[model samples]
Target: MTQEDPEIQILLDQAEELYSSLLRGETTLADATCSEILIKLETAIEKKKHELKQTSKTSQLC
Candidate 1:
């Protein structure tokens, strides 16, 4: 498996922290707001992963 890029890792870390806070009831975010934030973060993470994979493939072919 390929290593996660640092930029992606930072995003993942932020997502994890947000999730943890939500689980602990530390935030006042509404349910809909939380869902939207999570969805956006997930989408970003997926896009970053795809880009990393594509970059790695291109590098291998160089």
Candidate 2:
């Protein structure tokens, strides 16, 4: 895997954690700020999800 790829995953994980914290009242940022990371995390999640989806699809076709 690429080195930068892991960094992206790490940030996505962190963003997810922050989102959870905000949901539980552990974070004090405004909704916009919290939502910002949430958006990024969702995007990253989608990228990974797409990769998994393609992998599964290819394996099935194989």
Candidate 3:
């Protein structure tokens, strides 16, 4: 694991927390707010996953 691995994990952790809140049905945000934040977090997670895969491939080549 690298510095980014931990950082991305943190983001994932936070996202999960938010998801839990959303799941609990306690949030008052409109559809726009929910969709925007969820999209951002999902995109970040996907990007980090892709980066980690690339890093792993590069490491294997070394």
Candidate 4:
């Protein structure tokens, strides 16, 4: 894995934790709805996955 892979994994793990917290009713944000939060989390996860894929491709080219 590239150096960035671990960082991306960390972010993904964090997002998963936040998701679990939301499901458990443990997260509170005054200005955002749960659906909004989930959408954002999904976006972040997709972005990280894309980044990881790109990183892997670049590493393969080296």
Clashes of 1: 0
Q: Candidate 2, which segments miss by more than 4 Å at Cα?
A: 1-5, 16-34
Q: Native-vs-model 3 lDDT?
A: 0.68
Q: What TM value does model 1 have?
A: 0.52
On residues 1-62, what C-alpha lDDT tens digit does candidate 4 reach at each position?
32545654555566677767767778755322455545655666688788879989999999
Q: What digit string (tens of lDDT, one per residue) describes model 3 on residues 35-57?
A: 65567666777887888799899
Model 4, TM vs. native: 0.48
lDDT score, candidate 4: 0.64
Best by lDDT: 2
Which prediction has more favorable lDDT, 1 or 2? 2
Each prediction's whole-model lDDT (CA): 0.69, 0.73, 0.68, 0.64
Which of candidates 2 and 4 reaches a greater TM-score? 2
> How many residue pairs clash in each candidate at the backbone level?
0, 0, 0, 0
Please list all clashing residue pairs in model 2, or write none if there are none: none
Q: What is the full ranking by TM-score, best candidate first?
A: 2, 1, 3, 4
TM per prediction: 0.52, 0.53, 0.52, 0.48
| Model 1 spans with C-alpha error above 4 angstroms | 1-34
Q: In model 4, where is the ten-residue run with the lowest total lDDT?
A: 29-38
Can you give the lDDT of residue 19 in candidate 2? 72
